[model samples]
Structure formats: structure tokens, C-alpha cells
Target: MATWAIGDIQGCFDEFTALLRAIDFRPDRDRLWLVGDLVNRGPKSLETLRFVHSLGDGAITLLGNHDLHLLAVAAGHGRLRRGDTLDEVLGAPDREPLLDWLRGRPLFHYDPALDMAMVHAALAPGWDLATAKTRAAEVQTALTSDADGYFAHMYGDTPHRWDNALRGWRRLRVITDYLTRVRFCRPDGTYDMRAKGPPGTQPEGYLPWFALPDRASAGTPIVFGHWSSIGLVDGHDVYALDTGCVWGRQLSALCLEEGRWVSVDCSARGSGAGD
Candidate 1:
């Protein structure tokens, strides 16, 4: 069996199909690991969601910020903003099954056999691999529960930092934001919602999550998207594959087994930087 971990799709279904064909993916024997943002911003939000849903057990997807936004909007915690392209998913006749399946999907995925973990965004600093796996599950449980009261508190900043003692909906919100929306965090682990660029441009007080001291997963290959500005930083066992395909640049795919990286030119990727 072969496993390939690809970067953020962001609704560029055509680019994704090209990548899969280029890799000659064998559905029966190959497993695909997607780093999330499977929908929104591109022209094929519905198609992207449906395609990944069709993959079923053959694919492993870690929830990205956009994915979480879709879930929150579905559950009534978030409101759609301009440029959001998830209307089809929210109104589909199969909405129930689709949202149910999506809400239950893992936010952070790790395969010990491959010595790799894939997340939509970077892991919080100070967390080892085990810490990430454990904490990720905690929020996943809350989000997947019928008592999704957690969604009500999903827009806050108090629980922005990890606290083992955090309980209930607030805890779930913090966990969700970190796992899904986090980019740069202050040295004390507080997230800087205002900063949204490469580590070099980040405010002086913040650091990239992976660059923090004592980062246990520094040796384990961690695949993530959400940072097209950082592009493809090949260091400390971390890879950033969101080359802003939805912004009309190029879509990227990093083949885990072959160590082969491919980028396909795109005309409709995300152009909203400093966004």
C-alpha cells in the first residue's frame, strides 16, 4: 500500500485531479492524506467536498480553517462573509450526511508507521506528538457531539491558549481555533490573530509554532497547509504546501513516499493576501 500526503485543496478540484493523475494514484492500494481546506474560495467547493467524501476510508483528512468554518456555519456559530463559496454545501439536499461526516472527520491525523503527522495548520508550540494527538481528539469529540453547544462559544478569545484545565464549550472553541486557524503565536503561547504572513514578517514577539523550543515533532515529518506565504519551507521536518493555488498561483503536492514535490500552475487561486 502507498500513502501520499497532499497540501490544501481549497476547492481547486481540477488541479487536484491533475495531481492525482500525475501520481497515478491507485485507489485500491493507495491512501491519500489531505491537509484540509477541501472547500471554499475556489469555484468547486461542492465538488471538492463531495469528492473527498466519496473517498471515504481511502483518504485521511485533517480539518483546516475553512473546513472548520464550514462546520461552524452549518452548526450556526459562524456567519458567511463575502467571497465565501460554501453556499452549495450549506444548502445541498445531502447537507445532513455531508456535514455529519465532515464534523466527525479528524482535525489532526498522525500515522506512527510513517513517522508523520498531518494538520491543516501548524501544531501549537510546546506540544509533542503525543500531546498533539491527545489534545486534538479532545476538541474533535466536542465538535462531533450532538450537544454542539460548543459552537455557541466558538467566537471568543479567552481560551485562546492551551490549558489542560479548560473545560466545556470554551475549551472546545480554543482547541478548534488553534488546531484550525492558528498561524503565529506569541512566545507565551498566546495566538496573534492579527499576524498573517511568513515568520519573517510576523510581529517581533511571535514565533512560528514549529520554531518554538522543545518542539517534539521536530524530527517527525509534519505536513501542513494554510501558510502559502511561507511557501515550501523544507526544514526541521516540516512542509508547507499551501502555495495559494486558489489565489491563481500554483497548487502543490508533496508525495511522502517518493519525496517528490509537484506544483501545477493555477489561474483561480486565492489572491487575498494580508487577509
Candidate 2:
């Protein structure tokens, strides 16, 4: 069975399905690794969530920032942003189950045999695979056990760097950020949360998280999304597949075993970018 890794769908169900078709995805025989942002910003959030939920074991989906925001809003911890299209999901009959499944999803996934790891965004420069897994479990535990408290303190850009001594909400928030919202960061691993543009446009002292010198997770290949502006990156043992389908670009997928890409145009379904 082939394993295919796909970029953020962001509720663009038509483009998602089209890309699936383009890849000749066979749910019965193939497994899918989705880089999250499964819902929000497009026209059919409910449909997109339902379809992915229906896939069950056929797919492994990480929780993106949008996915967490949906849960936070549903739990009354977050306010809806101007471009959010998550109302349908919030109002759906199956919203509870859908959100529950999403909350339980891990922030990181690893395949020891392939030595490949996946996260919605980037790993902290200091975190090797072992540290990533442990830290991810910490947040997962908090999310599952005290979602109210977890979402309550989830928003922020402080503690811009990871510290082994961090604890409580501070620790959880930093881990969540690294696994979900990270982009440009300093060589010392301090995140430049404000820099969202492409690589060359990063702030003076920052570089893409993956480009950080001597990153502990450097050797192992990482499949990630969340930086659509940079589009598809297929080298340096990093696979960035978020091709901005929601922004009138292509929805991309990479065959893990073969390292080949299959994409579908999404201009007709484009609805601009939304966080």
C-alpha cells in the first residue's frame, strides 16, 4: 500500500477531492498522511471535516492551527475571525464527535521505519525526534484531560524559545506553537512569530525553522505544511506541501515511498488566505 502526504485542505472540499482523484487515491488500499488545517476558510468546512472523519484509519491527520482554533471557538475560548468559514462545522449535528476526534489527534507523527516525521508546522530546533514526541504527548494529555484550560491559555506568542524548565500553561503553549504555528526563528531557536512571508523576506536575524543551523531534527525527514507562502519545498530532507489551494493555487500531494507529487489546480475554488 502506498502512503501519500497531502497539504492543508482548509475546507476546500472540491479541490481536495480533485487532488485525491488526481492522485488516484484508493482508500481501501492506500494510507493518507494529511498535514492538517482540515477545515476553515473555504466554502465547505462541514463537508471537508465529515469526509476526512469518514476516512477513519485510512488517514492520519495532524491538528493544524485552524483545527485548534475551531475547537477553541466551539469551546468558547476563541472568537471567530473575519474570514472564518467554520460556522457550518460549529452548527453541524456531529460537531461534538468531529471536534472530539480532532482534539484527540496527535500534534506529531513519526514512522520509525521510514525515519520520517510529520507535524502541522515545524519542530523546535532543539527538539530531536524523541524530544518532539515527548513534548507532543504533553500537550496531547493536556488537550484530552483539560481542554477548557488548554484552549484558555492556547493563544499567545510569548516564551519565544523552548526551555526545558518551562512548566504549566507556558510549557504547553510553547510546544503547541512549535508544532503548529512556527515559521521563521533565530539560530538560538527563538521564534519570529511575526514573519510570515517567504524565505528571503525573513527578518534580519531569522531563518526558516528547517534551515536553522545544527537543528536537532535535521537528519530525519519532516513532512509539514502551514507555510503556504513558501509553497512546495521538496529538498533538504524537508517536504513542504501546502500549495495554497485556498488561495487559488494547486492542492499538492507527495507519494511518500516514491517521492513524486500529484497536484490539481484550485483557481475556481480559491477564496483567499485565512488563518
How well does candidate 1 score on lDDT at residue 96?
A: 88
Q: Give the local distance difference test score of model 1.
A: 0.80
**In model 2, what are the clashing residue pairs, if there are any?**
none
State the lDDT of candidate 2 residue by residue for 100-197, as single tens digits.
99999999999986779999998999899999999999999999899999999999999889989999999999999999998988988899877777
Error of 1 at 38 (Å): 0.6
lDDT of 1 at 129: 80
lDDT of the candidates, in the order given: 0.80, 0.90
Q: Which stretches of candidate 1 lie over 4 Å from their true place?
A: none
Cα-lDDT of candidate 2: 0.90
Model 1, span 172-266: residue lDDT tens: 77777777778888756788766777778888878888787776668898988887777787787888878888888877877787777877778
